[model samples]
Target: MSINQSTIKKLYGLSAGRCNICKRVLIEEDVQIGEMAHVIAKNPGGPRGADNLANDNRYENLILLCSIDHTIVDSKPNDYPVSRLHQIKNDHEAYVFNRLSNNRGYFEDLLALNTLFKYIPILELRGMAMELPSRISNRFEAKDMFDNFIRGNPHLYPFKDRQLDRKWCSVISNMEILDCWILGSINGLNLITISDMYNSDPIPQPCYNIYVNDERGYMALNKRYLSPEQIDYVSTEVHRIVQDFIYSHTDLVHYIRNNFNEIEW
Candidate 1:
């Protein structure tokens, strides 16, 4: 998903290259400015009114964050709570500078999201491949057979719908870290490749485990899988991820919104 370019400039101006959560002053050359955050999220209807300080992109609502903070708040708003957003307005006021309102969001004790980067691997792929039960000697046939089995029976596995309910802080934090890893583009191919018997698609390997991605179109497995427009798709993901580093907000839905229209044969 993507945001307007103006939003990026707004956030860059606000944070001045420093991460909002960690309060670490990132040297313009050193800190990688990641995203622009909404004090009150638009989804789940947090608040987007111009009259609301928390919702508007004023200095208070705006913050310059790293890739980690960007993903945490974007994916897990509750984890990066900020009560000060409510303090922005009363029932009638337009710009409540210091007083702050009473509304609620992710303003609890665990808002710092950078801590999770230490553990998350950045780019990891998890997929199933079909292989012989060890009795088959060719090895090649076993892998191919298992791959066929998985593709034929995707419904047999539940890996796609699994969820973990850890503390919001941990979950969001890791997600943020993962976003950076995908953006790192370090591997020979950038994203750590994973094999799949059933999932023929190659996902952009970010740090956090993909909990839910309704995205469609384009998965290029470098090793043994193929999908429609795989090369173009992988290239696009790399470009978009780079863009993500400059802007504070990246709406994946909006980013890949057009993919839905393609006819997948």
Candidate 2:
């Protein structure tokens, strides 16, 4: 039996408008959503079965993901950078085309549209659907979402109800923020350390937080071990990192001081 609309919507809302794995937010103009997948592949029972996935609809068992994610999860035992990821992508592409040719004909209809958009970069093409399309035959056409995602448009995706584990989210977001600060400081695209930020005093929390949101502040507030001076230096380094490039220490410092834009320091 097929999962129903309410079930899909419940997953979409639980995923809260982002791919549960990649955190890519879907929106209009590009990047459509993909299918609602089974955490356990349907072929486990030799054909699709309600009993196989009915108990696994919670957000933990489910993930709202990009089309690439569906191919990724066809990973046996499901993990990344694994050998299976490559094979599944190639195979899924072929399978999708086969399904389309059988069900929707070789011409571009619903299934063919889904198949073509799944593999093609639909962002460059005349899109199949700019917004969510109304269902045909009471079934969501999977390809419509695929077309939108390929084009970089956003869409809502659902997953089973469960909390997202945010530990890595915090880490990655902070890294991006850190990278932004470094890029601004050195402007040279070189590495800067956390300790460097503290050397410069009077570090403004807001300046750094914008890149990663409040994660940096919260992390600093909790780690009270460092001295005020050290933290200040680290904060300044962060600012410096975001402010100028770091090709050579002497050159960058000379450049920044020489060209200090009279912005924050």
- Local distance difference test, per candidate? 0.36, 0.39
**Residue-level error in angstroms, candidate 1, position 255:** 55
- Candidate 1: C-alpha lDDT: 0.36
- Highest TM-score against the true fold, candidate: 2
**Model 1: CA > 4 A from native:** 1-14, 24-32, 44-58, 84-265
- What count of clashes does model 2 give? 54
Best by lDDT: 2
**Per-residue alpha-carbon lDDT of candidate 2 for residues 1-265, written as tens digits (9 for 90 to 100):** 5566676776566554555455566444675565565554455441123454554544334445677766666543435332343344334445545665544322222333234335543332212111111101111232344435436532212111111113213322433444443343333222234553445543343222211213322111212334566445555544443332222223422443443333122
TM-score list, all predictions: 0.23, 0.26
Q: Count the backbone clashes (under 3 Å) in each candidate.
A: 23, 54
Q: Write the per-residue lDDT of candidate 1 for residues 1-265, one digit (tens) a residue.
A: 4455676665554444456665455555765545556765544455332344433545445556567766765666555456643332121122221223211111211111112112222111101011101011111122233335447545432222122112222323333433343333223333332222124466564333211222332222333233445434544544443343223222322222232232121
Scored against the true structure, residue 30 in model 1 reaches a CA lDDT of: 65
Off by over 4 Å in 2: 45-61, 76-265
